[model samples]
Target: MTRSAGLSEAAVTSLLAGDSVALEGEHELTHRFTTELLTTHRISDTTYNHALQALGRDEVIDPVHVIAMYAAQAAMLNAFDIPAPETNLPA
Candidate 1:
């Protein structure tokens, strides 16, 4: 989906592989924030600081909101025993 949105295949692959150095612009910040959010359940001070330095407050907030919303949706789906559809995209 990200690549279809215009990111290069290399960018998508780098993100999936957890290689932040290969990402650029908002993609880099979002990747860092998402990792912190998923692993810590909250953005850490270091991640928050880096985001503030690289993006505006709203930019930082947007990805956090997106991640949280999707996480909540996934939790609800799992609670109801709903299986996510398989995608043909590379893992």
Candidate 2:
């Protein structure tokens, strides 16, 4: 996470506080990326929500699986060509 952002130690505090626009931007990107990931992995909404649970702490957080799942979902969405975003409940 640290290396990916190209942030120095001094910049970490800002990232943690989300003082930097790019850090907050990462959050938004992550949300969308994770959303697509879950959909593609066939991971149920309930499972995804559970992963968010501090207690559950899913073993999988890597973008490969998450992004693949989401990309699959995106493909489905693209087939439909809908502009609207689907709201989901916690798994």
Candidate 3:
């Protein structure tokens, strides 16, 4: 399914940049997509990889953090049955 009206900035950034960031797309859509592609945690996508590569130095982090974070957050929203708003998306 395409981005309904209420796609998040993160989702827009991903499609436009050809990468996923900030957990874009409709909450359920984004979460489901992530679950499918990242079920095993060996995703090779550049955008997702960026999270891991930014470890130590100025900002230390684990790549899995991004996915893990999104998963928890997305699940919470899903649990609440919060629907996305309309974005007036183009055809």
Candidate 4:
């Protein structure tokens, strides 16, 4: 899906490897925001202000929406005891 959305292979690999801060293709601010948001459930005021300065309100909102939506989907899957799909990525 990320690839389909225009993420390069290296970027996808970096993201999967948890190198969000120095992603290969993603914008630094966006990836930083994503990492902080996912790990902490909130971004610090510093990060938020930096994101706001680098990306407009809409860009910041978009990632939040995507993260929330994915979290909700995961919760739903867990609630239903659905097995996660296997990935075809390399080991």
Each candidate's TM vs. the true structure?
0.78, 0.29, 0.34, 0.75
lDDT by residue (29-51, candidate 3, tens digit) is 33443554567655445534443
Which window of ten consecutive residues has the lowest lDDT sum in model 1? 20-29
RMSD of 3: 9.4
Which regions of candidate 2 are displaced past 4 Å? 1-21, 24-61, 86-91
Please give the clash total of every predicted structure, in order: 0, 7, 5, 0
For residues 9-83, could you state the per-residue lDDT of candidate 4 as single tens digits? 777787788675435423666777787888899999999988887777898889899999998999999999999
Residue pairs whose backbone atoms clash in candidate 2: 36-70, 37-66, 37-70, 40-69, 41-69, 45-91, 46-91
* C-alpha lDDT score of every prediction, in listed order: 0.82, 0.54, 0.53, 0.80
lDDT ranking, high to low: 1, 4, 2, 3
Candidate 1 lDDT (Cα, 0 to 1): 0.82
TM match of model 1 to true structure: 0.78
Worst 10 residues of 3 by lDDT: 54-63
Q: For residues 1-91, write the lDDT of model 1, one tens digit per residue.
A: 7877667888878867867677777777777788879988988898898888888788887888889899999999999999989988677
* lDDT of model 3, residue 19: 53
- The prediction achieving the highest lDDT against the true structure is 1
lDDT, candidate 4, equals 0.80
Better of 3 and 4 by lDDT: 4
RMSD of each: 2.3, 12.9, 9.4, 2.4
lDDT of 1 at 90: 74
